[model samples]
Target: MNGNRNSQDVVVACSRGITPGMPSFAEQIAKSAPDAADIKQRRWIYIPYDRYTDRTGPLTEQSAAATGVVIVESTAKALRRPYHKKKLVVLISNMRHFALEQAARGVSVLYVFSPKSHGQALVDVQREHALPELTCMTPAERELRLDLATAIENGLQMKFAEDTTWASRTADFTEVYGTYKPGKSYVMDRFYRKARQKTGILMQNGKPVGGQFSFDADNRNPYKNQIPVPKPPKFRPDPITEEVIAFVGETYAQHFGEIDGFDLPCTQADCDLMWRFALEHLLPHFGPFEDAMRDDHGQLFHSKTSVLLNLGRLLALDLVRDVAQAAEAGAIPLASAEGFIRQLLGWREFMRHLHGETDGYRLLAGHVPQEHRRFTQEVSPDRTEEATKAYASAISKADPYAGARPSALGASLPLPAVYWGVKSGLHCMDTVVAQVIQEGWSHHITRLMVLSNLANLCGFSPRELTDWFWFAYVDAYDWVVEPNVLGMATYADGGLTATKPYVSGAAYINRMSNFCGHCQYDPKKSTGPGSCPFTSLYWTFLERNQDILAGNFRLQMPYNTLRKKPAQELMQLRARAEEAIAHLQSFKRPAY
Candidate 1:
């Protein structure tokens, strides 16, 4: 009903960021065609997915007769690698609900189930439906972009337009950071400030409202049970979503994570509940305790809108706009609003553009030497040969900087079974892993501070850890996970994505969470049998990589401490670190 169509071209909605009322992805395709008649008669918009959800960009249309929309469920993608059960349910249910919603809106929808790859499946849809030419937004993932390109080369006529889901684009990154060179690190704060100036989100008369661009200093306080934590909003599954849960539980039963409490919003109507809950219940206290974690509460004060945003149910710009309005009206603190906005406008966009700048997956293995990288075969047995080959092709051979000097901090250990739900005696490790297993989610701090930090200190391979994060979390995608895992968390990129390593001792964890109180290990003892593994390994990490890290200005204090340590004491610390690594390794389970 949006516009008239006679079917010269069909729009394809790759459902990573497909929501209504946005501009069409075929505008350029329509404009480029010299015949105005050819551009005027568009009748169908085809929406596609594989393994329920895979694409990271959306095809939008404000005016078009989307008489038909296509949704593809590719079994090849599902079996390509074992994914978290909750992740599968979230994706499949959302896609199904989207299709039904479109059908209700009077659009003819074609839902396809195929055993082939995503591109081949799309080609099949185009031929089966007799669609003349397919047009879509450029995908956020490089692999998917290449997949579609291959389909195009193989005779599937498709035109691509820019994706509108992000607040910024490749040009935006270049506008602020200049043309990206391989192995160069871009500071996020600079990009964030520039973004704030351009968007005018928290600005008053060409200046930031609070006289600061970031409230990160005020956002790092530990939770002290000051306010009663609110329970997350749960939407009972409708029959459509229930069917998806049943399908995932029956089909991917062996996949990691539990599907019992599947409460994510699958429809546009339900997305508001989460937004309301976040503003009313979670936003007030979200800033101070943003970094805090508790064993009892899985999500303390975080909004968890990443899944919704990543799923295309909500728009990033809309969320930040509303948040800024709320802050202006005194509904929330300025610090809280700024903190939330910084994540989307700052970190999220930074990660995406950085992923593009560094050439996506190639960033993981290119800088690290061959001997230091962890291939998919060495990390987990669950990935199919096709998946492994695809992964190897993405990272190993296509890297533009494959000959770069290997980082001194690169690790080669098989990802410890501890990451796959094997119990590490440390309460922090167990608590975070249990959260991931149950919900396939944890806040950013838990991800950076606990899970990834332990992996780094334990010397687990960064590539293996990166892959584990991709399959383990609901919000994870290659475009987001690689920068976070390889660049920021593990510092395996030789300081290209992060200024310094994120490693820390038990003291940071103890100050941040209640995990240490319930832990069997003593946080104070670095060498004794009961010493905390994080504390012991942290010192050893410093000693092992001092020569490389000593030159880093940000790491000067730690390096100074390591240099001043007595010879015998440092030797004992190394012995304790070895013991801790052995203890952690003993709990290794086969990767899921």
Candidate 2:
């Protein structure tokens, strides 16, 4: 949620540019001020990013009434890493803006732009004032934040307190959640109160705002107007925000995601707009249509809430509750509600837990930097040698029922996919990469069919595939996308998320969509210039790697089809397909 910027005593912190979802540690430290009832207080300081005259004056002006310490600085470079110049600007500018907002909330910000380490900051502070009891920085995820704190603590060496303001000191989410369990009912029960407690969501009758807690089916109707699809909200940048955009561009020049248009919500009001749209219009048709795609609906059926939800702008439980209520209110349906809830509760939580518990944190670790790869959700893969690999991998990784961890992960199964590296062949790397870079989002079909298919087809290296996907995409977190992409999509680690590779021929594409009509190549014509690229590639992929695929039952159809091809005829077909692929690559953009 967007905090009111009117507080005079608040100092908002950041490890990077503070967006709506990102938590500011400066605010946290100030907010965590030792309750004051006991009065055995320590000195605290608040830092801002802008030139400090306005913010710092308030702190010095009001310091007489405020207990302990409070100094507002324009730059907290000492608290952030200067390793990346972009990081410095992002962190400082965001902190500065947030500080101004907090000043509006009545807090002070001392502006400083020195790239000094925390120890140096302490020395400077001591020279300016006296030894303070504590140094509270803003909320930041980069390791440098902690590094700065450690440096300050080491410098102070018992003279001042340095630490995160969070209630949890250890990686003890369990301790924070208390008796929460991972099962369905156990999860549901804990979700009610725990969600509200941790996230401050409003509740009704000891339950969530929505009486029933689901509205999936209602959200699945594909037919437009079945549910009113309102315009998703956007923030028209105020002068301050426009300046922030310019600052981000000039300062954090290399940041991965595009800042152009920069219209995605970054404030509480922005997230609320998205949430309101989902509840009133999308929740009713999100499920059944969740799986469907249309050219006209850029974000059809799907609620683009990842940015908000991940950043804590919107609590997952509250979102679930609202959708459920909407459904119950005759706004949506059961399937859609259930599906949406499952994704939020089951998929998202599982991913967070998986990475938190396993080695999936860094993806693949080998410096080999596997080849780059690409793929998506409406996936259908090649039914050849690659498919055999995919099948074996899937069988090895498949959860027999659901939530049942497979026993064959190591002792009997192929290695799991490391979320590292650039993937090679069979997976289409650039397509989805382009999509994510251009648009801060991707579709399931694009992932499964296009990217995944290309990955297997191209044989792109593993590590490259993993890291590229993780870094480029906005919504990619270690949990879901890693398993889905690294394991299920890329099949980089042999097989982790799927049993077999998804491969298909011209027929399959024809079955799915009208892509054939718009293409210059004909799906029906093989072994010639007019032959479909997919059809030619499909056979070449099979023939080139028969050793791995000859035995796969799924390959029977395509292989049988290949067997009908005379060697000379197959070579011509391969040539045609290769030409098509080359054509695809030679272009600055995909003509289609």
lDDT of each: 0.72, 0.45
Q: lDDT per residue, candidate 1, 1-592, as tens digits?
A: 1122111311232222323443332331222222223233544444544222213343235322334455666544554456788898888778777766655555445566554556777887777656667656566666566667777887777777666767887888899888776556688988999899899999999999989888889998889889999998788886666666766665555677788887888777787689988988888788888989889877998988898887667778888998999999999898989999999999999999988876763543554443445353322233344433433443555543222223338577777887888887889998899899888899999999999998888888777777778778988877788788877888877777688899899999999899999999988888877888788789989888877788999999888888899999888888888888887888647534
lDDT of 1 at 156: 77
Residue 325 displacement in candidate 1 (angstroms):
0.6
Tens-digit lDDT track for model 2 on 321-388?
Answer: 78657656777666777677666754565445433333442333242133322222111111122222
TM-score of each: 0.87, 0.56
**Which 10 consecutive residues of model 2 have the lowest summed lDDT?**
401-410
Question: Which candidate should be chosen as best, given lDDT against the real structure?
Answer: 1
- Candidate 1's displacement at residue 361, Å, is 5.1
In model 1, the runs with Cα more than 4 Å from the true position are 1-42, 48-67, 361-374, 377-408, 588-592
The lowest-lDDT stretch of 10 consecutive residues in candidate 1 is 1-10
Q: Count backbone clashes in candidate 1.
A: 3
Q: Please give the TM-score that candidate 2 achieves against the real structure.
A: 0.56
